[model samples]
Target: MSLRANLVLATCTACVLVLGAVPGTAGVAQAHAVLPKPVAYPARGQLAHQQAMDDGACYGWARQQTGVDPSRIASAPVPVIVPGGERVVGAARGAAAGAVVGAIGGDAGDGAATGAAVGAVAGGIAHRQHRRQAAALSAQMQSSNDWALSSYWQAWTACMTGRGYSVQ
Candidate 1:
C-alpha cells in the first residue's frame, strides 16, 4: 500500500478504537459513523412501548425517504496512488536540456546523466504534492457526506416529531 493510504487507515482505525472505548458511542462493533441522538419524548400521552414502536417506524420511514442508512454509511473511496511514467518523463525533459548545455561544454554524456537525476527528483516532489492534494480532496468529500448523514438524522427526528413526539 502507498504511504498515504497507510497513514489514513491508521488514523481511521485509531479514531474507531478510541470512540469504541467511550461510553454511548454508536457502538464498539461497526462504529463507522457515530451520529448524535436527538432527545425525544411522547407528547400526546403515548405509552412507552407504543412510543418505541412509533420511533422504530419513524426511523424506517426516514431511512426510506432519504436513502441514508444510520446504521452504516458507504463513504466515497479514497484515491489510489498510481505509480508510473513520472521518472521517465522527467528524465527525458532533463536529458534534452542537458544535452544542449553539454554540447557547448564538450561533455554531453555527463551533463545528461546529472540532469536526469535532478529531473527525476523534481518530478517525485511534484508527484508527492499531487498526492497530498488528492488526500485533501478526499477529506472534503467525506465532510460533505457527513453533512448528508446529519440531514438523514434530521429527517428521522422530523418523522418522530410528526408522529406526536416532542423531539429536540
Candidate 2:
C-alpha cells in the first residue's frame, strides 16, 4: 500500500473510534432525562381543591334549575388528581443541564451569564410544556365529569317532570 493511502486509512480509523466513543456519553445524558423521585402524598392539596371546585359547579347548576333545588340534588362532584411533580423536577434538571452545556459552548468570559440566560429560556419552555400537559389532563377530567353530570341532571329532571312539576 502507498504511504498516502496508509495515512488516510489511519485517520479514518481514528475518526471512527472517536465517533464511537460519543454514543456512550450520549446514552448517559439521555438517562438523566428520566423523571425524578415520586412526590409524597402530603403535597397533594391540589387534588382536593379540584374536587371542591367540581362540587361547587354541580351545586350551582342544581341551584339554577327551577324544578330541582340545590338541597334536593343527590349528585356529588368527582375528584380529579393530576400528577405534576415529575414534570417540575424534570424542567429544573433540564435547565441545569442546559446551562452547563451552554456554558461550554459560549465565549470564555461571558460563558456563565450566557449559559444562565439560555438555561432560563429552556427551563421556561419546559415548564410551559408541563403546564400544557397538566391543562390537557384537567380538561379531560372535567369533560368526563360534565358527561356524568349531564346524565344525572337529565335523570333528575325527568323524575321531577313525571311528578306533575314543570321542569325548566
lDDT of each: 0.63, 0.41
Per-residue alpha-carbon lDDT of model 2 for 1-168, expressed as tens digits?
A: 345434543443353344332222211111112112121221233465554454455445544653444232224332333322332333345445544664576533233333333434454455456556656665665565455445556655454443333445
RMSD of 1: 13.3
Question: For model 1, how does the per-residue alpha-carbon lDDT over 1-168 read when each residue is reduced to its tens digit?
Answer: 345434543443353344232223321121234456677888999999998898889889988989887666654343344434444456567766766786788867655655655565565565556556656666665676677778887898899888898988
- What is the Cα-based lDDT of residue 80 in candidate 2? 34
In Å, residue 39's CA in model 2 sits off its true spot by 44
The all-Cα superposition gives candidate 2 an RMSD in Å to the true structure of 19.0
Worst 10 residues of 2 by lDDT: 26-35
TM of each candidate vs. truth? 0.51, 0.39
lDDT of 2: 0.41
